[model samples]
Target: MFKNHPKGLAVLFFTEMWERFGFYTMIAIFVYYLQENFKWDQATVTNIYGIFMAGVYFTPILGGWIADNVLGYGKTIIFGAIVMGIGYAIMAIPTDNSYLVFAGLFVIAIGNGMFKANISVLVGNLYGHSEISLKDAGYNIFYMGINVGAFYAPFAAAGIKSFLMNNFGATLAQGYNAGFGIASIGMIFSLIIFTAFRKYYQQADYQSKKEVKVEKDVVLTKQQEKERIIALLTVFGIVIFFWMAFHQNGAALSLFARDYTHQFVGKFTYLLFDVVSLHAILFAIFGLAALLKKSNSSKIKSFGGIFTLAGLSLLIYKISSLPESGKISPEQFQAFNPMFIVLITPIIINYFSKLNKKGKEPSSPAKIGIGMLITAIAYVIMIIASLGLAPVYTLNGSTSAITVSPFYLIGTYFTLTIAELHLSPMGLSFVSKVAPPKMKGLLMGGWFGATATGNYLAGFVGRFYQEWELWQFFLILIVCAALASLMVVFTLKKLKSATS
Candidate 1:
């Protein structure tokens, strides 16, 4: 898989893998930790989780700016990694002070803001060579690396938490703290690997010479700068709702899993493996296959078919299995999106590459518009799922906990994953492709900043899961995403012109 890609790819791939390991590991259990340890209500916990996630994404603006103007990308990534590692370690301390935990989370968030976009910029830099024209394919490969870490985090977290709680004489809270500690271990390992490979990534280090030239040669007119800021603000506004809907994995959807889903495999052979995170493993296999298939035409086509069929089957099965009782653990449901990414990314990439070959590939803006529409559809799916389930509010405005099958959430995830494939990677690719050569790291950070804006709002939206009925909460998301999608479609021609 690394044969045609840059040597830096391996270094960055593992670095990102370990980073995600820590990040996802913490995320997998964040809500559970809040509820179980702090004894907070679901609403309070979701609110806090949303805020933390939002902050985590929000700081990238500063991180990106710093990398662009002051610190080089390499230094920024290193600083971010160290800070995140410390943050993860701090979370392991089992402190009673929520303020301290918040402080730790802030550190992690800032670090993520710095590291996430810069590293992606570095990866895109690797493809500067003519031999690898497959930037999308390359990102699909990198994304698999991300999921490899994501795939392991839940099981590792669940195992550590379960062990501590069940055997080590720790309370659920302590077990959670221990799980956070294990996540820190993953971070430390990543830091070590990154540092060791530092020499190999010398090329990824940011350069100031080009930036100096760009600054000297071109001055932005008042109107141009104003327009740029306005454009960013507009994009940010749309993203807030997108993230609010997208980030349910860590909040509402996770709670749904714990409450509604039948996690146990009942007489089904796949259940045994899936319960232990085999589903994630399947995702990894597909991701790896997608990466390797870039050079092999026959293999790409065969794998593409298999991937599409598998995703379709999963979606069908989940929809078909919707039950009246909503009792699944939402965290388990969180696995579906990444799993879907694993399955669909390759097929999407391949399909697009084929289209590109025939001069029929859609522009990035068009793809993003399509993504938003699909995201809207996903929420609609959830809204439908909510309809069959018991409504939280009745005629008297009284709320009741209704039992809805886990399938509702699963169906949403399946649809959302398809939407994610359309948007997230393409978003990253867009930033890499359009960013000025000298401003690559900073511009990439800007892309993450857009996502961060969404992430922050996602936290606030998560509160809805606690305050409103399932349908009501999901309906808001459907409308928001639909509007965003429509906006994208309306401006598609203009965006294409700008990027072109």
Candidate 2:
């Protein structure tokens, strides 16, 4: 999977993996921390989530500009990581002051702004224009690195909380504090890795001023530049609704897990709830991948068999250790999307590769449009889950006794993960391929800017979780996603031409 890519790709991949570990750990607990410790209502908590997430994604504009004109990509990433560490440390301090926590989040966003866009731009810069055929695949691989960290994050956060509560008689608030501390450590690891391997990806750290000198042959006429920018903006505008629908995972979907979805289940039927159970499945998956690969040497297949045996043994041990039933955390449900992304990325990449080989691959813009359609389909599952449930406002903050099965959410997340693979990475690849070199950073920020708008809307819409029926809220998302998909159909030819 790593073959043919630059060595720097591996460096950036690990660095990003650790960075996402930190960010997602915070995400896993951010809402619960607010509601449990600060005693905030769901509306307020989700709104605040929107603000923090919006800022985190939106700041890339400044970060990208700084990288392009001043600090360059490498320096901005380093600076951002340090600032993020400080922010997490502040969040780790034990306190009743909500303002302080809010301040910490703001700081995290500032640092994230400087870090996020530049790193993505750096990844895009690794491939020259002649290698456009490989660019989408490259971004797909990078996206997997992000999900690998994300896949483990909720488990890490939950494990830390469970350990502290069991051993130290810690409060949930204390568990949250400790979890935030772990996030800081993750950031530190990211900073160290990036700094140590700085030279490998140094080639991607192009300053805007150097565009004329570095790649002078790929000149864009003023008219061509205008058309390309317009094409990108069109894509950005349509994708806003897709993100607005997708980011509901952190807010409305999370609430559904806690209040509306069944949390307790029969023995071994709840692997998503237990780390050991999850690990058994993870190990078995890797073992099978290695063993099933036709190209693997016999020696490698032997190791794969060993791993599979170990995983089976562990699974048996885990089942014996479990009681009849256990309650699951809402945060753990968030892991489903990322884990699915990690598991299925190789398949999606291979699928696209086959399509490309057959001369029938969808244009990047077309893939994004299909993603929007799939997002609508995902919400349809939610609409089904809501079919018999009472409205949340009527429940008065109590967990529903007639909760639907966890499969509803698991299915939704599985479908949404597929949508994410189709849209998010493709969008990044599209921007990198189309954006004029001089404006790469800024245009990349524009993509996140659209995401910022969508994230805020996710928060904004989350407030209506009570005001509207569950199906009503989901239907709204379906409408938005479908409309965006329709928009893409109308503009497909123009986008493909511009990107080409």
Candidate models: Cα lDDT each: 0.70, 0.89
lDDT of 1 by residue, 184-294 (tens): 888888888888988777765665334433321234456544444444344545555667788877776676565544454332323322443344346445644664555
Backbone-clash count (model 1)? 22
Alpha-carbon shift of residue 25 in model 1 (angstroms): 0.9
Candidate 2 structure quality by residue, lDDT tens digits, 128-186 = 77777688988999999999898888988888998999999999998998889999999
TM-score (C-alpha) between model 1 and the true structure = 0.83
User: Which is the leading candidate under TM-score?
Assistant: 2
Model 2 TM-score, 2 decimals:
0.97
